[model samples]
Target: MLKRTRKHIKQLKRSITQSLNTPGRPTLPQDELNIIERIRKAAAANNQNNITRTQAYFNFYQNHPEVHWALLAHLVSRNAGWNMTDLKGEYLPKLLTDQEQVDFFAFLERGNWLIFQDAYPQLLLYEESKKQKRPLFHLLDPLNISKFMKPFWENMWSNERKEELTIALIINEQQYIEKRVIHNTHYKNKVLDTIMFKLQDVLDFNHILIPYTTPLQQKTKLVGGTVHHFSSVEDRITLGKGLYDLLFSVQSRLTQTVKWAETNPHTGSRKDYWPDLFNDVKESTPGQVHELKSSPCSLQVKASRIYSPSLPSVWKDWEHNKAEPGDWYPNKKMFHFVKQPIKQLSGDIEKTYCETIEELEMAAFTKNTFFHKK
Candidate 1:
């Protein structure tokens, strides 16, 4: 173990030395700088909100289908939008104070924004490389992408190891946010370490749902796994791999899920997939407790649709502070994250999601009633 630790320390020292000696933005040619500017503008324009980011990912995937990670990011971004709108949806407003909701939204928004800003440039640079018929990922350094990604992108350009590239991106982005958001003192106190965040585990809320239509039946179904511990980077990377496998490893799922995304433009509402259970419009008056109309056993909606607002309806575009500067590539240990075996995933979680909603409604209703009585 001591020998291994020494080796790791040696690797870390080499990585830091390489990073410190890396060239800065001044070295890039004027033409490459122009391309980088265009890429930055494009990323900024699309990074406005969940709606724009989700659509951008889909469009990128359509154009460059070889980048499997683009599609995975699209699907995952959809879930992030749904979670954002959920803050103003039927149940959460009852349970959280206005400030708490705002903090939670900020937490979600920062991570979403950071990932897109970090990743989208890499995507666009690859597109440029294709146009020029030469590898241009060296421009990634000027764009402020993680040094960890440049080599992966270079290797991908040469070898086209799509899955490995995807896993590398997962590690890079997760580490990108670790210091800037997850462990930051402010977010730790305000969002991550709070009871409300803890309640996510109890409620099984950290799920990345991929909505896809089955081929034979043409039925829309939810297939995803839950990440119980969001604070752990390893768990999040594992979740990304599982989701990627579920979407791409299965031929039927890959084709159909793409079809589903093509058909349903994400409106940041659960209604996009299960319109029977969720509505983007506000159906009930504010602060009024309504009886739960959805049945967990039969998965039926008997009454008015639960309010699930679209992204724009509840939240505005966030102008994020510049991401803290640094690369997250620590050592060769990160390669293990890319090589970890993909777990066999069972993509059936619809019933459990319904039950979670029911529980949330009950909790909100009880809180509302107790407050009124007091």
Candidate 2:
């Protein structure tokens, strides 16, 4: 009987230990776990509050079927020079309005992921074909163009940008295509015709080209080559000029901003640099931009006025501050304080303080005043 009891106790202990270990719980692969952790960190860095960040991560995970770690790594790579937090606080704000920032970031976070699935495979195919000296091209729309061009802008000061000759390459391709069509028609050219026929499949692709900027990089400079299609010559001209303008503007302004930020002893590493840009007001001295509004206290106060307790009442007697002390007295029918049941601790009596509307108003005003000063 004693041996049987001991055996039963051992079995119970084993079962309890197994249950505590959570044997039934599903486990994720190491790579997937790493991606999830990165996403969590990214969301936290981007959002203002913990609750918002947590909700955003859940929403992102639920919406995206799978995570592409490679694509994510590319976006956050040192070569890319993108800070995910800056997308919300700096980059997007330049491209979008205040109202559009939230939805745009959410869209960008997921949209890029979806695009990556389609893009990465094509990029791989292009890479392989390029080795055999085969022509491979891809079409670039507004979204992907920005992604492709961003890296070039990042290396603006480097010799790689000049050697890549992005604009010159596109011009060469355009001239080659036009000249070949005309030349083939001018003479009976079977070889050129056959080559063009073979390329016809991918000819319409909006091809983008990246440059080999770094030796340590695994990626190549020749990304995609293709004929760009436009509705009209005027539109094409406008877009071409626009592309050059965008590159030039970003290159000039970003170079200046970075130099200022890095060299200025007053500007700390943690300081935000975006607000200092695009002021367009040049200082009497060089390399200084005008400062915009530091804080949105005025805007906040203006917005709060609509819903504030201080707003005029529809009925004069029902105003927020019109309530009498008698109305809040014990057992009063008009208005009464419902006393919360208190638990005695160490035989001590504690005073319960009730907050008043006037006090709340004063507090809000004080907070606003403090914000305005900063």
RMSD of 1: 4.2
Q: Candidate 1: minimum summed lDDT over ten consecutive residues — where? A: 1-10
Candidate 2 wrong stretches, greater than 4 Å: 1-104, 136-241, 248-374
In angstroms, how far off is 97's CA in candidate 2? 16
Q: lDDT tens string, model 2, 55-140?
A: 33323323331222222122112111111232232122233344343332332233223223223332332233335444322221
C-alpha lDDT (0 to 100) for residue 141 of candidate 2: 18
Each candidate's lDDT (Cα)? Answer: 0.83, 0.26
Error of 1 at 167 (Å): 0.4
- What lDDT tens digits, residue by residue, belong to model 1 across residues 224-325? 988988988888888888888888877877889999999999999888998877788877776686567557436565777788988888998887898888
> What is the RMSD of candidate 2?
32.4
Per-prediction TM-score: 0.91, 0.21
What's every prediction's RMSD, in angstroms?
A: 4.2, 32.4
Query: Can you give the lDDT of residue 257 in candidate 1?
Result: 91
lDDT for model 2: 0.26
What is the number of backbone collisions in each predicted candidate, taken in the order shown? 0, 5
Give every collision pair in model 2: 138-206, 138-207, 139-206, 140-206, 210-221
